[model samples]
Target chain A: MTNNILYSIKDLSKSFSQSNKKVTALRNVTLDINRGDFISIQGPTGGGKSTLLQMLGGLEKPTSGMISLDQDDLEKLGEAKLTNVRAKKVGFIFQNYNLIPTLTALENVQIALVPLGIKKLESERRALAALESVALSDRANHFPSELSGGQQQRVAIARALVKNPEVILADEPTGNLDEETRDQIIDLLVNLNKESGITIMLVTHDSNVAKRANKNLHISNGVVTTRS
Target chain B: MFFTYLRREISKRKRQTLLVSVALGTSIGLIIVVNAASAGIGDAQKTVLSGLYGIGTDISVTKSIQPTQGGRGFNFGPENADSSGASTLNQTRLTVPIFSGTFDGQTLKQIKSTKGVSRIAATLKLNQIIFKGSIAGTASNPTTPQDPNARPRGFGGGNFNIDMTSIEGVDTSLTNVGPLSGVNIDKGRIFQASDANSQNVLADSTYALAQKIDVGSTVSVGSGTFTVVGIVSSASSSPETSANLYIPLAQAQTLSSNPDLVTNIYVAADSSSNTDSVQKAIEALLPDSTVSSQADLAKNLSGSLSSASSLVNALSKWLSIFVLLVAFLIAILFTSSGVTRRIREFGTLKAIGWKTNRIVRQIMGESLVTSFFGAIIGLAIGVVGIFVVNTIAPTLSASVVSPGRFGGAAPGGPGGPGVPGFQPPAGGFTGRGTGFGRAAENATTLKLHIGMNVSTLILGVLIAILGGLIAGAYGSWKASRLSPAVALRSVA
Candidate 1:
């Protein structure tokens, strides 16, 4: 994989107003992630890890500082263009595995390709391939309810991968899974990153999970410290 | 792609969507049905009233006399003559004859030539005794014989027997008084100008039949027995109480015991003629008698039917508003609940890069499809309901249901032969086969002059689409505003 910087964040800060009081979530933090790098963000609860990820994913704008992806400043893009960028370039995996309960595992993956205006048959084929990549091909027809917690999270990961985006942002990918299932999910994500050379930024508090990344980012008191 | 999203969204919230659609369809359908029925009945009533009373007659007049002056009161007799023996004695006495002076033929000619007199007709009213019992006397009364020529006394004073009359008149063009004088001959014939000097007379069918008299049979009126040349139906002048015996003016005068007096006079004018001028001319010609046109007479006879029709329209409008409100509330509730239940699914779509606008379009499309189906179902229900109501409740005519004529046929009773019926061919609640049937039938030949217009259909469709759009837009906006992080957190 190329050793080119894909995301560069500098002096990023964010604060929210709650009950007429200002509560800072993230304070001056700087980071750089290269293409194909798998980085894990580790911090205690309320450590601003999720807030930092949201800002980098363009899901929320930083209160201050600059976030650039592939030399394109995200702050400069209009709302519509920002949304378009997120749709085309970023894939998100939530902690809850947010697989739409009404859809099957394959359909959850198929949804990612819909925004690309792919034909139904091709989209389904791509979704099937994504499910197969996660080793859930046999369970493609099962709905989220029919799958275990680990299986649902795997389906969510497949949905994220089907988009072929430039960055994969996962917020506590195995936060709700048992240790055994969590280990399995981490292994699958690590192998995916190694094989596809896809850049992954994951938020996790587990040391074992963090150890799987090529680089570790620690956030404390709104400051991010990168340790190789 | 958007439609696929819509299908998914609907499937996700099937119950909520269905509830909203059903509520909207029912409300809108109810409004449509009520409005259609009210409009239909209003038009029918207008046609019936117009047919019964010509156009633009603002007033009506009848003989008014002081009850204490011993003057003859206005005749308010039943539509059919007395069929029982005790009713004739109760008939109000006519002490002041309709006409008391000598019958002057020169005066009739003079009245004919007067200006402002569009058309004039002279009428006579009298009571003639008729034999109603069987020709053969009952076993208890051997004195009476079974013979057509047998003369019986005191028959006119009995309830089962009474004096019937033949009113005669020439075809005079009176200003706006055509309905009062325009006798619709349903079966046989009408009095002609040629019959003026002849002995032929046209009697009311109901009266003739009740009196056991047939056409071509000779019946005595005054001093003469005239052959029943024709049978005329009753005019719609008084729906409940009008039994007219029509004959030529001259024949009527000759048959009356008092030949010089005429019962009443009616004047009809051309559409362009001023009613006031005709009234003035008649007043000047006959200073001692009353002079009034059809308009003046109608005002005194019955209240305006238009006011009643307006009341019905107002009621229908209120009903429509109520239905619309109900539909709006239902849509709001169902859409809100639907959006709430689908939060997590929406977040997933958002994560997969679905724009808010695309999501909105999908919701709207689903709502529109559901609303369209519901509207169709509601329309079907309304049409069938109206047909069933109309069929079962024959008393509720296509015309305004007047409180006074609740149990009987309407005045003018389904427009006589050659006259159109009250229900117009084009107006009424039309849907399913009803509207199309009417269109197909009316295409070949014109029957009822009124019909359904494009505005009705357009209005219904527009309201339905508007409902769908509103529901869909509301659902979409709600879903779009959801926080993907919070939604994902909530998903178990």
Candidate 2:
């Protein structure tokens, strides 16, 4: 039923002008994502996989189309409302980990709770819990530069999951890691989706990472196709 | 969270923080120093004006007159000759200076009642000339021509010498409002109320020193001897006084044969704000008299002190503004560049659901913290600068010319005199004019002492805060306009 659908897309399209030429990144794509679904979008470089992931996170707007997360329409909402949706309902992870170099691991996790206006002690307690979930509790006081790539990614994951959002969108979350570290990060995300019933949409080039998700979509040159 | 973030961010970039604070601190310090120096220069100018105008006397009124023809003369007759056909004549004449005109005593009463006049004092300025010499007895010399201009046959064989002294008659009861107000008693005592009608005088220290006179000594004026009650020095440390000798107003009027009249009136206004109005009122009251206020008097000043005043007012003022502008510009540029270097960081913040306003606030907080440190450094620098200025105490010299036209006097001598029983000397002699037509010049030297006030400190802090706000606004605007999507895409 429609009540179980977490995201509904209709005729979504995006384009950008590069060197005075319009290049289509996403075009007339329609899809539905049910609650608690783990979906992976695999595509080559310059494809629409990351664009779709960003749209789902409300980080980018569609040139023409309508997309809704629950009852709120991402296209119709103002910038402030979109920001609020991102704060309350969505979390994002980048390929570079993107942890603030000036802040420690615990502070990076606590930063997510800042927009929620939680009390300082409670934010700290919850941030420590999130670090424990990622097995990064011992490194809470370590800065990003002091942490290994896999450890920093885990801290990034702790930051994303600390807010208890409805969904997490990751753009190449494990692209910078080696074979063993990439598997660890992917296994952590899988456990978060399975144990917490939180929906996830990830864009990756690794077929193995895509194979772990329950649903997989492939795209190239702005067109999407289902992979059974 | 904001404070923690700001603290970490500033601590991380210690070099940039120090650079901005030092630049702004230099500007604010310069502003304080310039302002204090200007105050010092203003006091110096007031000192020069007060040399003649006197302190606490806000307005002055005077009138100028041409000297009388054939300037006052001294002659001898048969009665002035001795039995040896030799005569010694010694006489002292007290008269108003050739350039001053006296106003009626009734005008003083009217000025005292003027709307803004808080106090009034009148002075009669006079010049005393002493003529002491011998004249050949001409009673038996009938061969001498009766024509006063005729050249005689034989010389009189006598020498004459003349001396001039400036004298002022002041109201002993109200010496606090006129020229006497600017004098400090160096010896003896000031005039008491009982000395108002007596033949007592206050001699200038410089004049008394040069004349080898002291307190309790008697000085002759108009053939009358007056005891010197006190010896006074110029309050501004000037070389001369407004007058050499100060006597009671009554005695001066009587001696000068100008009874119940005053040549100059010194006025005190109720307040400094009322000075212009009082001057206008007095000007209207006596249309023919010249009324001058302190502001008007400052413009009439010249010499090195005036140049210093101009340098402080024009050059230092502009220099302060220019340095402040440059400092502010440097702050803005540094803030903008710091923000530019952190574009990806801000984009990551926004992507993590940090609102635009929150990020803007973080940037602004960092700038304000830096600016606070700048204000502290500026205050320290300003205090040091003021201390140095006061310690050095540079001296400046100022000169002001009298505000009236000089009157010329005609030369008088025995050559043109035809007194009975007096014969013209051979190779007739002539008395030269006193050459008093030149404008009166007053010069004073004073050491400058720069002082700091509470308001100047407040201004320095306010300036630092303003610079922070300006720089923060520009930086925050740049931070706020960042599109998170585009920013992340470029970095990726």
The best candidate by DockQ is 2
**What tens-digit string does per-residue lDDT give for candidate 2 at B1-492?**
887789888998899999999989999888888888888888887777776878889999998765465455565554566776665788777888655788888899898999989999898988787768876644455223355565544544566776667788999998677888877889999888899999999998877887889988999878679999899877785856677889999999988889999998999999999998899999999998989887888887787788888888985679888988998998999999998888888888888889999999998899988888889889999999999988988888887776752322322223213233334343222222331222266777888888887898899989998898899999999999999887888789
Q: Which residue runs does candidate 2 get wrong by more than 4 Å?
A: A17-23, A219-221, B68-89, B103-117, B134-145, B148-158, B192-195, B273-290, B300-304, B405-439
Model 2's CAPRI class is: medium
lDDT of 2 by residue, A1-228 (tens): 988899999999999889999999998999899889888999889988888887888889999998999878999988899888988899888999888888889998999888899999999999999999999999999989999999999998999999999899999999999999999999999999999999999999999999999999988988888887
Instruction: Judging by lDDT against the true structure, name the best candidate.
Output: 2
lDDT (Cα, tens digit) per residue for candidate 1, span B183-280: 45655555554665766656656566666666787755455556777665424332211223544555555555446555455455544456677567
Question: Candidate 1: which stretches are off by over 4 Å?
Answer: A1-3, B32-51, B54-185, B189-203, B210-315, B387-391, B394-464, B482-492
Cα lDDT tens digits, model 1, A101-169, are 767899888888877889999999999999999999999989888999999999989988998888899
